[model samples]
Target: MNTITRLFDFPYHQLEKYNLSDSLVTKYGNDWIKTSTEEYLDKANAISRSLVRLGVNKDDKIALISSSNRTEWHICDIGILQTGAQNVPIYPTITSEDYEYILNHSESIYCFISDSEVFEKINAIRKNVPTLKEIYSFNEVEGCKNWKELLTLGEDKDNQNIVEERKNSIATTDLATIIYTSGTTGRPKGVMLTHQNIVSDVLMSAVRVPLRAGDTRALSFLPICHIFERMLIYLYQYYGISIYFAESIEKISDNLKEVHPHVMSVVPRLLEKVYDKIYAKGDALTGIKKKLFFWALALGMDYKPYGENGAWYEFKLKIARKLIFSKWQEGLGGELELLVCGSAALQTRLSKVFCAANIPVMEGYGLTETSPVISVNDMRNGGFRVGSVGKVIDGVKVKIAEDGEILCQGPNVMIGYYKDETQTNDVIKDGYFHTGDIGEIDQDGFLKITDRKKEMFKTSGGKYIAPQVLENTFKQSRFIDQIMVIGDGEKMPAAFIQPNFDFLKEWGSRKKIAIGSTNKEIVSNEKVISRIQEEVDASNANFGNWEKIKRFELTPDIWSIEAGHLTPTMKLKRKIIKEIYKDLYHKIYS
Candidate 1:
């Protein structure tokens, strides 16, 4: 196999060549409904041919703005690529303002929207976006050339040459996709990744945990707009893996059980929520079940670190898995080989607990600028490390800078943020792409991320505090679901916490507090705040005095994507949180 391929080159060709899809029929059956490989190639060729008919040429930007649906998304994406045009994907959840900004900023001439909602959204702002020349819809909507209709126009004999010529025009270093990340900072900046960047990442990641012909079921729910999931999509195809598109975020668990996937790429917040759900269920268990649940977790947490081959605590874990955690496994469909987590730092305790439960949760690290994956814990091949994001994959080089910021140099690193030369220069220096995160490599070469260099804050007492470390400690409390540590130039460290309402609501009922109170009133209650204060104080004991959270305020609402406190990838935008709840922090210190 060639070690590298151009983005415009057909990746699905490799799948067919390898004959790995033969067993896919047996594994997925009719549920694996995708635009078949032949159809995909035909559709892609047709679309590329049509784009040529429309006078689209190499390097012309084509934007795909839609939700993650299997067929239309691929048709447009492959179409755009096969035409030698750069594909820009926008999350359907983005606002009208952001949509307009990306359309004009990328200077996209051709755009494919999913449904009428997207059509209406763009149409409402189209008059203002001069760069947008045409709008195509996936479904037949009023006043638009449907996607299939556009492809039909390219049936001329000469169109095949257009597809071939377009493919040949693409180079490995040419821009493949421009993913816009609305990071914690101001407006979103376009992260430009080339064909070599992501394809290399996908192949390299496969080395750490080889994707075999039999081991190939995946539940695709994470937004392909994000690099982590996007890279996996190509990697799955590269490995001839059969992917099952999840219906939506709401149906992931059901989809997981139905797909019974061998592997999944997830974010830490999802894992944390799953752990909380299991813990909540355990809390409901009676007598023996309840005793067994805590006992297993305690054993996992207290057990000495065992390398991959060692099973010092396996005897206790085996009993625990059989008696208590087996039902939990059943809930996840029992066929999960590994769960990979990244996009944010996972609490070490939570990682420790899940791995102990025999559900191997391999935590990793990366940023959007780095083609989104720098390091991930090796699933079962290399000896696993509990607290780190495993070893760097082959072909990727990582080094800690003087101040602990992770610097990366690899084929996977983005070509730099699109069109923002000044800002791009600030981040990508020399050959290394500076990931604004801070971390240190352990003696074993596993990367343990401490905090974001940009997010680390100082208190008025002249003490530097890494809020992520403190926040991770607080997540262990089980009562505090999400917290934003804010002590930047303040007298002492204080925090705005979003309590686990499910846990609190249950606690409230047991204590006979009013059941129907608003979340704000519930969290603000003297008793509830005092209880959480004890949790903070307990968490503080584990950290150095300067790093401890001294005082905190609880918020009624959870920090979420819709709430704007968290990014879509589940990373907390601390500045946004602090700005949103400035009064709460002020009141706490006052």
Candidate 2:
């Protein structure tokens, strides 16, 4: 329990302290496959030995691309790190061009993949990536080598001493992983994080995560390529909590029923989807059932932390929990103790309602460069505050700049962006990492993010607008699914909305209104336009006249990652969105 310094030390710490029989679980077909801590270490060590045999050196880069998280990724992670190579976890959804760019940038010597799709992507770019020596797949692909072969090569124990030597030689400050930032603009930059950068983060952030330790189970579905989920993986291992990987995002509902996980990490986009599904279910009810559902929901929307609403509110909340919210708990597998929301700004409505439903949704804030945890809302004590990311975690210092950027200085800060001192220096100045996020620390020290500094824009009239804050608040409307506030060099601020089509269709049927099926049809429907206008007008009340959305257009398509309108993390690729919706943009400002 004591001497944990490096990333690999986490599993070893678990092996000694808990030695869990089900440290990592992944679903394959109908079976819930398990990899014990003993097996996890054994396979990792074997991969280490095999990599050594292949002449893999310290600081050598190895890239991993997985369609979804699996036990092999974790095993490969430990195995790769123990061999003193840096793991470059790449998003599976990105194009082959991105793969080639990151591989060449990191100078990755070996690449491990998940399936045939990923194998084909890498195979297509193999000629361009001359540094890549071999490709190994977790799932057997037709022409690709399987990872088991690498493990087979390391099955021999004689080279165990070499792995031990490599493990010992790896310092706490040594580079552990080279995470390529999902830059909305330009090529992705490699953010080089150290063992200390993450180890310190996991340890400090651990106090904020509520867990009973070894026995509790966690369901991990967030892209582990991102430090937010990757860091949580190490934290789960540190506490010996069993981690169950969902099959994929498409199958999360089924997996939730089977796993009944006590905890999971989520992004705001997922919460939006969950809320929509839950809202649709509620709307499907009839007569008094619908009335009761809405009454409970209305009570939920007025939620405040620590009983600030007094005894009467708590009594109604108790009834709401039994009559309404208990089903929300049951839908996500009757046993969700905590759902840590991160990666983007979560709508305050989502946080408030989820909390009122007896679902603890703690919002956290950080970046891949911070080794990812700067602050997180916790349920214990007075640690939580509504609409805030949460109190800053222990061992990290946060101070707002005069212009309102959240600057932080702490052990969790990254070593630097790999091979790019100029870009790194721009952000990390005077030992403080300028988060590029504008926020203010409240009197009680809860961090409330306003918007991304780079994203905030000044209109032609010199009126400044923070779109993300507006977007977050407006998304609280059940009708508006996604929105982008615009007016960068224009007369007034406006928006492009992607309405909650699911909710719209249900309401359409209920009201005997034909809102249509296709996105174009629904968006053009006069009734639908008027309804959305009402929601927009309502949300505009919270903003200044200059900042308020003056006129808005609805999109005929969802802004998504694959469509190139959104980044993988679900943040609006403002430039990309504008390019695609230029016609709509002109319609508003013309």
Candidate 3:
């Protein structure tokens, strides 16, 4: 509403408003080459025009299946908007079953696939989707329309006007995108977010983080298909921040070195893995270097920020930053100012560890329903607090129900689940969206999320247990990679652990135990079992009796996308695991 409505109407059009001439670079090998934002926009416009030429009209749905990238993928996203069509992005790693369901369910008229490999999968199942009309592959493939060729169709002036007509007709309340939730429990439901929902988020997030023009730059990697990443795309554009797309997750370290981006957003799983990598590397250091690393880590824990009246702690923290944290900074390409984390609860220890390292890791909390952000720690305003998702963002009203469920009412909240009116009314009651998250507010107004209402379970002893809280605590232990606390409608909670097998394998070799063995053999070994048990026991001490994990079992293979144990977002599919491993649970309890 700032009166700058001419260049583009959609959220993706925000790119044209700011630094259209600035460098928008994507990674290639070790090089960071610049491509003008205008050039990127022109390509997008061409695609948009082409879609119009293909007879795509307002309110049409276009499916986008791809991974995180900087260049062409972004163009396709913008093109979807320019045509006044809804973008339905599916994860590149999505299962064939889900892919078929999403395509057929959404009635997508067209789809843009990332590469030939992805195109092949869709082509195999394309016949199943009766509504799908055209297929465009980002990378060239046989028998498919190339992405560049599609752009040529829009080059005609008449085609361009059709796209413009569609854009002019779009209302603020019109659906901008349909993001299907990759739920850990059930079939994925498409969440309909409007232009208003995302626009509100862009403004509110800026209020909390202050991504001022020319001051902030973001390195995008988290799948833009998810609300958490998608919302930030709008935020970055609205504030005129430079947006750089990372080449891949593997190249983040290198990309950070090159871009030195001030801000980035990620989930807890990625952060934990990065922290683990740093720890693993730190273990290789010897003598003073190793001792210094631990000393710096401890120093970070003790360092208190300014305005907290901890003068003594602040002074000590400064010395620690100089001595121990400086090297840690160097490893991260040295210029990270703030990291906004969401999707799952970040381990408090991880947040503190990064903060101690002089990089402010601000943890935030929200679901896809609330445009994915309601609260986040404000680094500039308040000292980042551990175990809290900061204060709620401005313009968002939060109230805790008598049952302790968190309810949020704001423009940022989604309109409702697409095509599911029953669910829509059931969750959004009396102008408030029931977040289904339990939380409490402190005197300082920082929100501490306690548990998920749906994920909580009761033990056979009639004691209530919240698995998420316990899982966060358990993850603090480096030995445990991922855990699912299960004892639902049972006597007591137990866990199915996916151990840090690499760490265990290394330990076995070091101790001269049977090293070259299968995962089952290694896990069953007395030494490995004892080591895992010690960590589990330590975690259990903080939990109430029935909530404590008892008699855990370990699986050798890593639970991964290929195995379907985890979603593309890396969240465990609990019900799937429960069904697959029912025998394992029965064996432990019976």
Candidate number achieving the greatest lDDT relative to the actual structure: 2
CA deviation > 4 Å runs, candidate 1: 1-3, 8-10, 18-32, 140-145, 155-157, 183-185, 303-312
The TM-score of predicted model 2 comes to 0.98
List runs of model 2 lying over 4 Å from the truth. none
Error of 1 at 201 (Å): 1.4
1 or 3, greater by TM-score: 3
Count: clashes, candidate 2: 0
Q: Please, what are the lDDT tens digits per residue for candidate 3 over residues 304-364?
A: 4443637676776777778777777777767777788887888877787788777888888
Candidate number with the higher lDDT (2 or 3): 2
Could you tell me how far off, in angstroms, the CA of residue 176 lies in candidate 1 after the best superposition? 1.1
Q: In lDDT terms, how accurate is model 2?
A: 0.92
Please give the TM-score that candidate 1 achieves against the real structure. 0.93
Report the lDDT tens digits of candidate 1 across residue range 1-590.
45448653434545455444321221122365544556666667788788889999888899887665455676668778877789998887777888889988899998988778888888988998998999988766898768777777877658687678778778888888899987445678999988888777777787775456534677777887788887777767666666677767787787778778877778888888888888888888899878888898787675434543357567777787788767777778777767778888887777777776677787777777777678888656555777788888778899999999989998888888887888898988988888888999888788888888888887888888898888888888878989888878888888899998888888889888764478978876888878888898898999887777878888878787877887778878777788889899779888
TM per candidate comes to 0.93, 0.98, 0.94
